[model samples]
Target chain A: MDKKKRIVIQSIATLLQNANLKGFFTGKIYTGQSKGVCVPGLNCYSCPGAIGACPLGSLQNALSAYKFKLPYYVVGLLLFFGTLLGRLICGFLCPFGFLQDLLHRIPFPVKLKHFRLDKYLRYLKYILLVVLVIVLPICVKMTPFFCKYLCPSGTLAGILLSFRNSALFQAYGKLFTWKVIVLAVILVAGVMIARPFCKYLCPLGAIYGPLNKVSLYRMECDASKCISCGKCSAVCEMCVDPTKDANSAECIRCLQCVHECPTKALRAGIKSKPETSKPSHEGEKVPEGRMRGKD
Target chain B: MRRIGTIICFGISFLLIALGILDHQFQAVLAKAAKVCLECIGIG
Candidate 1:
């Protein structure tokens, strides 16, 4: 059921990401006012078909111009998404995350368990957020270091759009060569490790990770119904043990565990408390269903 | 306590967004978006 929902949501997100179909064919970007607002996902702002700004790109641009103005709007937008949905955006909305999911489904040899190195490397995203996205852009006079030098999403978008315009190949240089190498590494690593970018290097994920602890939408577990089967932890892609910490910063709220639980102990919702109801109330003696419904 | 914190954060974010709209900051964002971002296109 969750897989079907994921497919539907991913399809809609892909459509929204490429809503400007004409731009894809013409090799032109959407210049409408809608482009001014950032999408709540890791989409490339320069994608010819992208109709909205990328939050990471927008943040860097605002930071670059910090000497003259404050980035209240972009910051506010980021805060809104973070506080409301947290990494649910990463799980359900991000095109790059969706791409990683598709790649992992290709029947390749994948890393099933987390390693010590992986845990340590997860902190790199925060460093990337602090340095490339914020520091370098401001220091280097408005140059978006992360977009130009690092982001595989931007590189992939540039590649797709460049295919539409052969003249772009003529303008490619050393920087583009470096970006291609970076994109290649990320692509190969993505196939081996689930969400390598989100787990290790996406600055956008960095911004949303800490917010997951306090986001309104959350994962909750009913300890009373839990059978200690470790199924939820085993199914988690991000190496989070949902039983130990249902609202872990690493959890994307994908609901795979909620679907897999035998006792129906796991749930994802905006509610403050985890529901502890039995899967079937037919055996209860007090006709508790009607009484509970009143609450 | 956490719920209250979340509400406060949301309130601050909404206020800032409203202020941005009133200040016409969207124009600046539009100006940035109208031009193709060279760095993002892998040319700059």
Candidate 2:
């Protein structure tokens, strides 16, 4: 892992959201004009120093107001982001993803990879996206179901807000208690399981997953160069077998596989031609002149 | 066929987003942005 680059990017993202340290100490969210514009990552809108809105929160609020209006801005922003980079946002930009990456770095056994159930559990995020983020808000009429009942990001923001005003902590009821417990479990499990929330629960990741197949940015393996060494797969934290399926929904586009490939077989970029599948036999030479460069 | 389908989807999404911008939905977002979202802060 390029720990330095990851840390630098994470620091930049954290600073971008929490630029107003005074707001953090004052227990006041940045109720500025920029807050209307949603940031591409999973930072909470209610965070005391956050300067941007969360897409999930914006989506729900817009849906809740569906009786009177359309959530055009929120929907448009999400589509623009999804079509552009998909889960690449999760890999490079999300504060929650950075937190999970940091937590997983704390030297531990890292046990969840071996569980067969983990594969199936990855589908759960889609269900959460459909049910909690979409259906519940429309059905319940004005309830931000995902943010109210499930968002650990919001829960973390609540904790941050509580640091400045003890009344926020005192006001915690059953619902708040439930969210805190959920956040605690997710934080603890992050130490053992790589991106537990991202794999199993994040609606934002679920929304971006399908976009992976169609986004302009694509990852490819050069079959002619690949030696079938399994180095790319071994280094991938997202469990993507880049050789077999470089554009899999599970791929966060973290580029670890691309960086780790000793054979220089992997590449990610905008291009004109479709990617070729990895060869079935390792020794067979790939046909020439099929792959095209950028248009 | 799949590629064509994807292109069609993108076309529709871009159109809807254009319509959204024309409708000026950003005003609604700005209105919400002015106030602190109490529920999001975990305070009743």
Candidate 3:
């Protein structure tokens, strides 16, 4: 998809998930039936306008309640989303991701495309997923650590609701201040780097990242069409080499690489058949060809 | 094989969701979500 189309889809998904307009005016959260259902994106349930639950938040909550029962609902829903669309949800549905995308669009003097620490930093999200989201909640006194301490989307919801509810503003304490600082830093980093949070911090992204390889919707690179011009890697903000690993865990399925491929070798969609390779003769050596490019 | 894998994943997900609902986990999710998540908003 093109940038405009992705933006439009992101906008619609964000708005639809937070469709409780009356709650925004009343400074109250939606308490309807739909609140039980999880949206595919990371929208906070506490948001005054939110009509659906956040999968990450719900998962943490369920994990916290592990003494009572397992988090079957949240886990199942997350698996359902991951197997179906993978990080497509991050690219086209997450409100916070959309916010980051918008922030990255703001003209900056220095856009940090890549840094030496970047590869190492990418593992942080997985650590957070295993620790804060899953382990801590189950081990501790059922505390949703990530939501309580680090979710910028939750912090944004609190800030937005506090605008209309003076009581919520008055209730703000050291924790709120710390959360605000975190949000500010993420937003500022987002202006300098494309999707810093998604790349390095989002637990939801971590969950979906590995699933990209096996998701029903996936990216495929046709070696026959590839000219190894390196256009796809050059355009990928996520630093993924599409020709080398079309279904890399790092890919958000933004489709920019697909659009930028000179040979139209990269494609994204549901695949019906398993990948087939041509047979090679016994003891025969194949010539090296520029079918795939280096990262 | 890829198609089968996708189908198996879908089947497992749906089955899990169904089991969760049967176990009344949906009600638990609904009750929690309906309330103001104090921790989420950094209130407590």
Candidate 4:
């Protein structure tokens, strides 16, 4: 998909998920029947306009109540989404991902595509998934650690809701301040980097990342048509080489590489077999910086 | 094989979602989501 089409899809998805317009004016969360179901992206349930539950938030909350029973509904919904679309949700649905995309579009002096720490930092989201989203919630009863402490979407919701609710504003403490700082840092980093949060911090992205390889909606590279022109890699902000690994976990299915491929080697769809030609740089250790799109 | 994997995943997810509903898990989610979610908003 082109940038404009993707942006439109993102906007529509965001609007549909948060369709409770009256709640925004009233400063109240939607308590409708739809709230029981989970949205495919990283939308916060506490947001005044949210009509559905957030998958990660529901998972953490369910884990907190683990002794009672497993969170089958939330886990099943997550698996359903992962198997169906993988990080395609991150690519075209997530409000926060859209926000990051918009922020990255702001004209900036320096755009850091890759740094020395990039590879190591990519593992942080997985660590957070295992720790904050699962372990801590199970250990501490009824505490959704990720939502309370780390979720910028939740923080954003709090900020938006507090604007109309004086009581909520009065309840702010150091935790809120800390969350605001985290949000500020992430937003600023997003301006310099394409998707710093999705790359290094989002637990939801971590969950969907590995599923990209097996998801029904997947990327296929036709080796028979490849010219090894390296245009796909140059255009990928996520630092994935579509020719080398079309269904890479790091790919969010942005389709920029597919659109940019001069030879039309890369295509994305459901149930297509991916074929990769030998990379020109095969058998040689590529420098980390160069491999990850360093300028 | 990939198609089989996808079908199996779909089957499992549907079964799990059904079982969750039977277990009244949907009600739990609804109840929690209906509230202000103070912790989520960083108010509690």
Candidate 5:
């Protein structure tokens, strides 16, 4: 199969029937088989056959007390992957990211400007990543804040698991109300902006972002090859400055740069040279976008 | 080093996945262990 096609298919897989069945098990079932790894993606844990653990949930569980404990292996795993690939996992592996990509396929769209309310809004995720994903769990020690308060994954999982057990419905109360509100917000945002939650609130993205510059796999601009068509930036759904800082924090490492470069001057894969040097010419503007190379 | 990083990424990812599956399959056991060993394994 074609590479892009594979990615599309992978993204679509997030929507299938993946009812979680783990809650039913009351005994030990460790068979010493399976990947034994955490996927560094925002895949719904409730999805049936989900072998990977949710880092956000794990982090909250870990920081539950002042003393705190849980093998740091999961957090360590998240950092290792985030530092190595940044949001490349979102571009390549996350089922939620795939959902956003599909939503972007819709004809009606409103692109956001970087200097507006959007810039300020980006900070919300930092607040979320720090407080909800980290601080709250440290303080509360009762429930997963993001899962109970904001994650859509819980809803997706709940619909699968709770629908079967009526007692589960009775078990739901304030926690369910809180999660539904968050899901409603996420759902509404998906309809409005291309990726409102991803753009503004995912903690994992916030973690992976700073590592984009240092990551081994990255996007690069061949300044030496010539041409400054702004098409790359215009085509970017993430609103990143591809030519100026192709692998900057804002970039999700999606292949839009590779797809939109008319000059074939831009490439995505790895860093070619040290990027500390400033561009010799800064004001030159290229055509808004170069279309046609998604696959 | 790059190869090591790549191998580690693959290894660690699978490890977490395996652990999650174990927790799922043995939810009761892990939950019980979590009670006795909340801070024991460094998972608060």
Candidate 6:
């Protein structure tokens, strides 16, 4: 998107606060506080000032409480965002993702791709999303299983809200210790990898990924007019191999494809006919200091 | 087909939840089936 359009969307995101949701995130009780512009992403449901239920948490609750599936408001919201903005939310909206990006920029000078554990741990998020967020809630009669057990968001939120409600603090026990351990691990991992949670465990990513193929917003590759020079893939923070497939489930639709394409061959939400051109598979040299903005 | 599948799967989940809500028996059946499946896999 152009600069003016980008500014407008960002201002909307910044200005649109679900006040009730914010209050909810700030408090311990669910007052059904339903106000605020819910930024579509994997946010902490229990976050003080979180107006909407974390989609993952809601999914877990729906599974455990009713012993069946519940309404998927979270998925709908996420798809809406994915349709409208793609992974621009990661760059511009999600507070957690934003935090991770900021931490990575912390000048401590850490090498990201150098560690095997960093690469391998990405899959753990997927496993966590499936097993902790989905399966355990269904099987164990637990509400917000991932939040209760594994979420760093929960730990952060708990630290803030528990101060206001002493009863909540008093309620902390061995399970809390376990959650703390998980939080410590997650924190360490976050410091190491760019987005350990999103890469490995975010079910929201799993959902958003499939939608990228069909969403109004997308990261698209022109198969016909393309050289497979991996310039697009080289600079991608999400580690998407844009040349192999631009809209792969692994891709967050960040539009690095569009920005990095030296030939200007990539785009968002393809509607144009494929040009009758040769397929070039040689990885091209990626340019530096790239930026692409979207709503 | 995928949309239909999503709807069907979601519908079944609601049915299970509705049944479970109305009857602990259904919950028992669900929990039982799940536990048994898990145990069979040595997950317990």
The docking category that best describes candidate 1 is: medium
> Which 10-residue window of candidate 1 chain A scores lowest in summed lDDT?
A286-295
C-alpha-based local distance difference test score of model 6: 0.54
Evaluated on CA atoms against the true complex, candidate 4 attains a DockQ of: 0.53
**Which has the better TM-score: candidate 2, or candidate 6?**
2
Q: Give the distance in Å from residue A230's predicted Cα in candidate 3 to where it truly belongs.
A: 1.0
Ranking by TM-score: 3, 4, 1, 2, 5, 6
Alpha-carbon TM-score of each model against the true structure: 0.91, 0.90, 0.93, 0.92, 0.72, 0.68
Candidate 6 lDDT, tens digit per residue, A1-295? 4334544544454334223444444455333424112346555544554554454555565567654644344344445565555556655555565556545555555747446675676566677778877788788874556666666665766666676756667767777677677667756767766666677776667666555554445555665446667887887767777766666666655454577687776787534333443434454433321212211
Kindly list the per-residue Cα lDDT of model 1 for residues A154-243, writing each as its tens digit: 888888778788888788888888899998888788788888888999998899888887778877766556677998888888988887
**Superior by DockQ: candidate 4 or candidate 6:** 4
lDDT of each: 0.80, 0.79, 0.86, 0.87, 0.59, 0.54
List the DockQ of the predictions in order.
0.56, 0.47, 0.59, 0.53, 0.09, 0.05
User: Poorest 10 consecutive residues of model 2 chain B by lDDT?
Assistant: B1-10
Residues A117-142 of candidate 5 have per-residue lDDT tens digits of 88788778888988888877877875
Per-residue lDDT for A171-262 in model 2, tens only? Answer: 88988888888899999999998899999999999988887777777677776677789998888877889888877888888888878888
Model 4, C-alpha of A20: deviation from truth (Å): 0.8
What is the TM-score of each candidate's chain B when compared with the real chain B? Answer: 0.77, 0.64, 0.91, 0.91, 0.52, 0.52
Q: Over the stretch B1-44, how does candidate 3's per-residue lDDT look in tens digits?
A: 55576788788889889989998888888888898888889888
Predicted model with the maximum DockQ: 3
Q: Report the C-alpha displacement of residue A165, candidate 5, in angstroms.
A: 2.9
Residue B30 in model 6: shift from native, Å? 25
lDDT tens readout by residue for model 2, B1-44: 43464476577667767777677766667666556666665555
lDDT of 1 by residue, B1-44 (tens): 55776787798888877777677666677777767777886887
lDDT of 5 at B33: 22
Comparing 2 and 6 on lDDT, the stronger one: 2
Q: Model 3, A1-295: lDDT tens per residue?
A: 7899999999998899989988888888999999888998889999998998889888888888846577778888988999999999899989999999999999999999889999999999999999999899988865899999999999999988888899989999999998999999999999999999999999999999987867988888767666678998888989999888887889999999988877677888874333444222333333333223211
* Interface RMSD, in order shown: 3.3, 3.2, 3.1, 4.6, 9.5, 11.9
Q: Residue A88 CA error for candidate 5 (Å)?
A: 0.7
